[model samples]
Target: MAPSRAYVPSILLLRSLLRPLPRQCSLSHRLPSAPSRPKSKTAKSRIRKPDPQPVDFIQRGISDKPGDDVLNESGVSAVEWWEEDASGNERFVSAITNRDELRKHEEQHKRLEAWSRGEEDPNEPEFRNMVIDELKKNPSFSDMQDALEAMKKPLIERIQEGEEVDKEIEAEDEMSKEEGIREAQEFLQNLLEEPSLEHRRDQILEIQAKLTEWNSVDHPEFLEAMARLNEATGGESVEEFQNRLNPYLDIEHTALGSEEEISPQDKAEMEKLAKGIADIHDLLKEGGMDPELEAEFAEMRREIGTDDWATDVFAEDGEIDLDKLERAIAKFDQAELAEAKQEAKDEDDEEDLSPEERANPELKAKIDRIMEDPRLMERLAVIKQILTGTKAFVSNVKSAPDPTTLPLAHMTTLEDQLKIAENDPEHLIALRRLRVNLLPPYNDHPFLRPFNEALRFAYVGANDDVRRVLWRSYLKAKTIPGLIENIPDDAWDILWYSQAVDWASNQNRFNHLKILQKDLASIGRDGPPTQSVGGVDVNEA
Candidate 1:
């Protein structure tokens, strides 16, 4: 329905030919008049542009506006235009009407051109000046500048100062080591010369202080002095010195391990002592059992008639049947009364014997033989000392200010006695008695508290066998609810030191120690549900 493009040129040519030529005769008449006279003086000519017309209304759907259709189709409101000035030179009119927008565009264009030329933009100077002005308005700007200036120092000078500081530290460390060695030597000399208990105690305290300051127990000079001191003190044969030196010594070697080869005479004496120790063990075991008490208990059981008496005594609602319990208690009282009467009768029979009859020849001969054997006599002396020490310990524990109170000095004395007892078979029995009597009711006492002073003392003063017992006790103590939370840092340090000693002595597996060390390192990092001290979890312990 539209005309073909090929006919458009011919149609335009026909229209141009149909147009009439304008009045050629009138042009010839006007041209003759204009050429008749030329101006006497030349004049400059000026061209003036007409004023722009103002429109009252704009049509929305007009198609005659140039580029309007294209702008509507592309969704653009306005575009840049070109306009002729009065001098007939073309000038560009930007679509943006805002002066600030026009200035920003001009700056962006300059920045792009500068970047292409690998040069800094001209606008950056003005921007940097503006930023500096803003920073100057801050209250602390001058103070910050001063601080930065003060912080500036030459690298060489700082390195030199650091080196000097390191030298001073090295000098101090050397002086400390020398002082510790000298003090330790003096202590050892005084202990060797005097060998008195009071002198030894004071010197030992000094040595301990020095060791603590040095932060190492494995110093060569200290170890040598300690060895000499131990020899002079009779190598754990003297209980006081053993207790004082135990925290610094290898417990396995000094307290528990076998001695080196001895002379035949000394060996004979040792074997005799060994026999005596075995006898003591047998005696203690026999003394622990009471046939009368056992027989009474058996009779009581018979009287109670083994028919789930507990159920009969306690009703379904957990109330005790008073009649049945009273009958059972009456039977127990009768058994105890009979036992008491029999004991009194035996005492009277003993009193009826004459003095000479009481001292039988067989018993006298046995006693005389024991007195003649020096080894047995010496063993008996040690046992007497152990008994005396145990009695003193019990007295001290009972005389404390309160059930939960134990003075440190008294605890030290008790620990010394325990160490002495631990070295002999008879002494171990006494230690067990102390544990049974004191540990249960007075557990809050510092010396008897679990994983505290008690465990530390046991580790230091007792042998491997006793340590195993204490460790088992410690593990058991952890099983009690709320007990783990009460464990202190010192307890974990002691345990870690014990494990370290065990590992060093090749008594513990390396993998076990490794796992323990890892767990200790992870304590505060990945904390477990249970409380931990020194990185060891109570549950794991």
Candidate 2:
């Protein structure tokens, strides 16, 4: 304020020229400063400028981290990337502008790659390339069960449906139709056909193998196939069929998938009577017709000594006088009848009671009750006659080590002989001894009939556990002859002891007859009868 400043216009202009250029222009050392506007006479004021920010300078086509939003002052954001797909297609992705959307898109792409490589995570929802609606429309698609029915069909049939084959057959010429059908049939047969006897012997075995191989044994189609195979290999008789299917396929002897009307035991009993009559007829044929013999034979055969013989002998008017026939035979051959009676006595005398069983109070009571019943006594006497008289008949029976070795006509005779002589003291002494070993053992007990029926049923029924138990019991008896020796005559004792033994020692040669000989001794000294044999339990008649 003291001295007035000198105004040097040229010096002021030089100071202005020396000022640095603006940032927007080139920053070279030789560059001239930009021209500035002259100062106005307005009041001087300071303009606020923002502080400079630090910048990260990244090189293109080099190491660049993701998640970085590089934006200019104009609100623009972008990043460059490279990618290669599964098909080996390489591409340079354009600079993406959005950070959130790009991150999402990248994650999805990675998941897709993992899925295509079969690296699916269990926690995620199941994913298929095709939709479910599309899968159902395809007939070829099936689960584990559908595959089972397919297994039973022949190879060609499986490859093409039956309708398709029919169509193909229809398309063929008439001359070639037979050839086509034959080829198809042969093809079907070959699916399960076995050339080896070892394999073909058992149809059940073949079916079992197929079922196991295909894991479809329980399926209905597989069952049907099994039945067809069984029918193809089925035997003519129950014995033949049973022999063919020994320790497998527990099929019962049946007619049309039902129980036999007559029990095997009853049929066996009836056959014996028929055989006896046949023997008598043959003997009469050999003896020639002496008028006295002929007249007596006619009377015996007619059950009449006179015109009113039916009323006099049967009273109930039945055919064939069994008693008169016996008398007629006795008159013809007194020595033969005597020998037969003696033999019957011998067979009935074979069984004797153990001292312990004879001493049992309950058994003694049962014995007393049985002795008191006239029906039981009469039954016992008849059995004794049959057992004692069968020796001559047995001697006449043709025999072989293997019954099949006999002629077909003789096979029936062989089976009859085996059944009749099973307890006849030759084929099976152990079982015979078991039956007759009682103090007064009958040739057969009535309970034995039902007991055997039960065993046979159990063998083929669904009671596997019981069947195994009975099998083990039978094995024990069949292998050990000593077990059958000295068993009690009472049925209850036999039934009890048989089951309690670790190994069954009964041959089951006589089925219930062997068991009935012991009477319930298995139930301890005081327990009641077990009531059930195999699956058959005895019911009072």
Candidate 3:
């Protein structure tokens, strides 16, 4: 029935809350409003109508619009320009047709501006962070990284193993070299113990045969042994043996072997010149003149007699008898020519003589008596065989491969041989020849394992007497041709230190530690110090 007025108002408010809201039209679908005309003082102001545009209507039954189904099926409500959604959010309308494209362009422009300012782009992927994130999420990527680490670990181990193997090989090589040296020494000692020269020669031949079998015919020790055998068998001194082998030993002579030989006439002229110079020196010394002036006067005397000759030439102080001096020189020349001719004749006669005829008559008769005895004849035949064998041994050595072209193993063997023969003066020529040949090439050879091996053989392997000789030779050489000038600083340091240690160990006077300290201090003060040790510059030595 008729309730209170407050109850009626409450009922009406409830009814209003239950009523449905009207559907809103999208801004795109709504008709545009006409623009208002401006007011004029005259009442004749008229509004102009806008031109008509084409209209597109929606088809209901089967829609042809590409995105119509997606929007409808997804239950997306149309948002009007001024209307709010159920969530009470206001809708926005932009003038830009492609707002997303415009936003992308703006972002790109911002990136460009940031780049121009040398600032990192905000959108740029952080590679380290991305890698870390990938490692976290992607098990396969982590596995791949672990695999790479595992591979690297094995590679490092292999390199270390290879280095160890190289060290082992070097040690083995050193051991083998020492063994070979010992064997060679034993062979030499055995040969020395043989009482007879014939037996010694036979032992040397056997050694040579063994060396040939081992492909070490070019071994330095064998060459040296052959040299000694030649000297002994040929009844010659070391100098004579060296002189005979000069054609082979001399680098220049060997290099020039293929060239035209020097004419006998040229040799004779050279001899004459040399003899004349020597005679002039002798004459100067006898006359109490300065020996230093000898060379100057020798040249002058050969061209136009010296002032000393002027004294002998002049009869009066100013008036010189040049014709008489010329006659005397002519006579001297004739005498020299006659003497040379006589010598040549004598040599020819000597060459034509039989061995028995050439010998002293008494010696020849004794030899004949000895020949009658079978025992003596047998001994002579044995001696002849020894001489032949020794000559053959020398020939083999001469014909062997060039030491410079030898393999590292062979070169090492030769070095060992040189060490073995270092104490023997008889092998000096062989040592020098090998040293000269080997030094230049080995000094800078790429394949040389121990770079200073050749230098050690030359300087350290030698005895004290030989070392002194070598130092003297180095000093007197002024320059050794073909020596590598651009030797590494480290190489020089190693060589110098090794030599210093060797010297200190040998000589009781020096304290090696102090010497080393002094050198190190000098090096620190002035880079690569050029201090001298035992009268030799560190670098030069």
- Stretches of candidate 3 off by over 4 Å are 1-148, 197-541
Ranking according to TM-score, highest score first: 1, 2, 3
Clashing pairs in 3: none
Candidate 1 residue lDDT tens string, 1-541: 9776653567879999999978664212233333334344332123232333312122343434545334334345445656676688877644544445545657756755766787953223333333344344344365575543343333234434545655754565455445545544555556556646554676466666666665443455556556665765564433343233322222222222111223466457446544554443323223232454435435544754554323233332222333433333344445446545765776768778887655446534543554476677685454445456555655766433663476655466545664554544344333332231121233453433554435646544645444444544554444332233233344444444444344222223232334334444433323323344565332333
Each model's TM-score, in the order given? Answer: 0.17, 0.16, 0.16
How far residue 400's Cα lies from its native spot in candidate 1, in Å, is 5.2
Candidate 1 deviation (Cα RMSD): 32.3
List runs of model 1 lying over 4 Å from the truth. Answer: 1-274, 280-371, 398-470, 473-541
Task: State which candidate has the highest lDDT.
Answer: 1
Could you tally the backbone clashes for each prediction? 0, 25, 0
1-541 per-residue lDDT for model 3 (tens digits): 9776653567778898999977874423444496445677453345434333322333342355335323344344342234465588765532222435445546655655766787843222232233334344443354577655553453345445545655754565455445544554554555556666654667566655666455332355656665667566554443433323211122211111111123366446434433433343333344244443445455545644444443332221122233443333344345446545765776869878887665356533543453365554343344345346555655766467898898866656545665545433334323332322223333344423233344445443544443333333322221222222223344344334443546421331122223333434432433233555454333322
For residues 239-301, write the lDDT of model 2, one tens digit per residue: 333323211122323212111123477556545544444444444444343467556555554
The TM-score measured for candidate 2 stands at 0.16
Q: State the local distance difference test value for candidate 1.
A: 0.44
Ranking by lDDT: 1, 3, 2
lDDT of 3 at 332: 38
Q: Which has the better lDDT: candidate 1, or candidate 2?
A: 1
**Where does the lowest 10-residue lDDT sum fall in candidate 3?**
251-260
Clashing pairs in 1: none
